[model samples]
Target: MKKNYFFSIVALLTVSLGSMQGQVVNGTFENIKDNGLISNWGMNFFTPITIDAETGETTQDFITFGCWPGFVFPSWDANHGQHAMQMTNGLNVTTNTIIPAKSILFNDPKQDIPGWNPGIPVDLSDQVAMLGFDYKFTRMGNDIAEAELVVFGTDGQELGRATVDISQTNTQYQYLYEPVQFTSFGIPASIQVSFSMAKEGSVPAFGSTLIVDDVIVSYAALANDEFQSTQFIVYPTVASSEINIVKGSTAPSGNYNFTITNMEGKTVSNQSIQLSDNNPFTVDVSQLSKGIYFISSKGFSTKFMKQ
Candidate 1:
């Protein structure tokens, strides 16, 4: 009995480690040198600039009207106010990635941009979490303004918002360790997250500069519950026509048959396939109806939906 218990514990640990091995990053902005990477990734530019990779220097042609023309700005900015925005070597060494906001011009509260948008059609639909990065605000002059972290969900609705006040006397660099939760927006797939600054009143909109570094995002597990020794998962609560199955084990030579059933114990779909060594499999649910269904294979059973 003791040996059986020990092996069970070991199996559980192995499965947990395997599940955590493939958390994907929705997007990474590490190669934003010049406008090449940004433009290629569908990012619109409001400023003409050159990014020096060797020295991490970003220079913008301030004379161009498009440089700072709009009332809203998406990327980082710098102006001639005793300090110009430049990438910091210290943050780069610590985070192992180029950090934005090191060389920042005063953050104009009037310049707020749209954040994340989970493009779906439901409430409490999409959930997103971002980790890493630290923000520091320095009050050079006697100016007071407020900063905010905004999250937008599917259907272009504001899901979450957090505000921080900036003043001249604050010494400690506050880490924005806040999490945004969206429970009702029914988006089951990918979403976007953005960070920006805001102002309270019309106090001439002082240039309060804010710094950001080491950005990371976290996501929910593909499966809702633990898979037995032989199990897999398909997720995004209200899944679209397409679904993904993440495998659990890496054992060689395993043949499994997938079966789907409705809530009323009626078989909906079934397929047989042989897994290669230990690779994951993706199944298409486009033919399924818009209701709760169960997927069973090997010795495991899980629930999913098609919308």
Candidate 2:
């Protein structure tokens, strides 16, 4: 039963074709088909391949099968346009496991076919900082919905990644912006954006829907600019022991509260610093574990790495 679920997920990365190019297209979910298919994106649905006994020809039958009414569909609860994409968590009766509706800028060639590669073509001509989207989530129990953005180099090495999760129930749409932290190890060539109704360990619950719209590739900093730009500059993104927060030209001349959080959004350190002079303010991060961490004051945020 678990093996069947494994193949089903692999199918998601294999289905889409030619139109999967560059940045996200039809992000508004406005180009939905009558049968609930969205253009320029891939949604998970079951359609078995059939072969003709007489002709020896194989073809995919246009049959949509899944949890009733399918797991993904178009909804009128849009934030930017007339329609938005909705994904719900459903139970796979045969396997008794949760089947999540997923939408992705999916890649090419069927997994059963030769030389199959998965992921969307990315064009980073612009200074892309993060992914921004508007969503409304109705979570059940401890279930959570998440969205992720990943950048891959030409050699298939991960260049950067960012993720945001919806844990609380929100009837009204809320805007979310998540940063993509680059490793500065390779040249980015492709990217993949995915949204799923629930993450691992989420208890199966019906009607836990996530409505998403206006998915945009944000090019500017996802955090506040005044402090991140003028007030201070978090330098040496890849730091070993310490990170210098240099006061910028228009830095506010006063003490402020700052916190450092890990990628899981857990605050590991809470401290205050005075920013009234030209000398750089250094923060000791040697005690923190090696991984990605974010530093922010008030609403201004930025990220760094502990090497």
Candidate 3:
């Protein structure tokens, strides 16, 4: 029995070997292949074309190719690491091979196998306020490079979408952010971020480039269950002297009895107080000991720390 338990522990550890704690995979564009290709990105294939039948000379043509633009590149101009995803919408007639560029790298790159999918899946069960990234764009003539951030539900429904139009040419990278509103299902289950060097049906100009690095996802500090209605905000989550409970946005106004308990399941205190949806309520915790505690009133229950 002990030997079976030991193997169970080892199996659990092996399963969690490379799991990330937050956000998408490889957001820094640092993970690369031995051939210098970026990891977690969807890849396309390009076969050499024979231009001269006798000499076997080859060339590339934009007349027939994938919309992924130029092969995804890794540039030394990394924001916080050794490399960043450098995507360019340029054309070269050199004798070489090209492939489709994969965008929307997830937090987990190992799932990016089989070479092609609309996007790599991601887990966004955490409440995220917005998605942000650093980028620099260079377009010629009327061509523009755009970045798209999309969130999807388990049923394959698009929950929320944020789009940024990149038309101006920026030599220096700039910080940009987009808000991700939650759905009725609490948090989304998957996400895919794609980029376009030019709009549909339009061709990209030569030498156009878009470099991105360090995808940052800012999460709402509150737990999901605490603010499902965007009301009943409790402040000083780590209670010091007292705790503040504010009711906002159609919050119920009333007097309710409440109880506080310690981690040992001991009922520390019980009391009743009047509260208004507009006015804030203050609770005195000067007597409670410094530890973890749970507060329950009406139908809502939340946990906080006391110190």
Best by lDDT: 2
Candidate 3 has a TM-score of: 0.52
Top-TM-score candidate index: 2
Query: Tens-digit lDDT track for model 3 on 1-307?
Result: 1111111110000000122234445667777765455666533434334455555555434322323333565679875557887776434445232222335443434443323344444454444445666788776668766667777777888788766666777776655556666554535665666666675545566556778876645433322112222445666656767987766476578776878777556898887867785676888887888755667676555555566
Write the residue-wise lDDT of candidate 2 on 229-290 in tens digits.
Answer: 66567877668899888766786778878899886678999988888767878999999997
Ranking by lDDT: 2, 3, 1
Q: Which of the two candidates, 1 or 2, achieves a greater lDDT against the reference?
A: 2
Q: Tell me which of candidates 1 and 3 scores higher on TM-score.
A: 3
lDDT of 2 at 24: 50
lDDT over C-alpha atoms for residue 19 of model 1: 15
Q: What does candidate 1 score in Cα RMSD to the true structure?
A: 22.0
Per-candidate TM vs. native?
0.31, 0.55, 0.52
**Prediction 1 TM-score vs. true:** 0.31
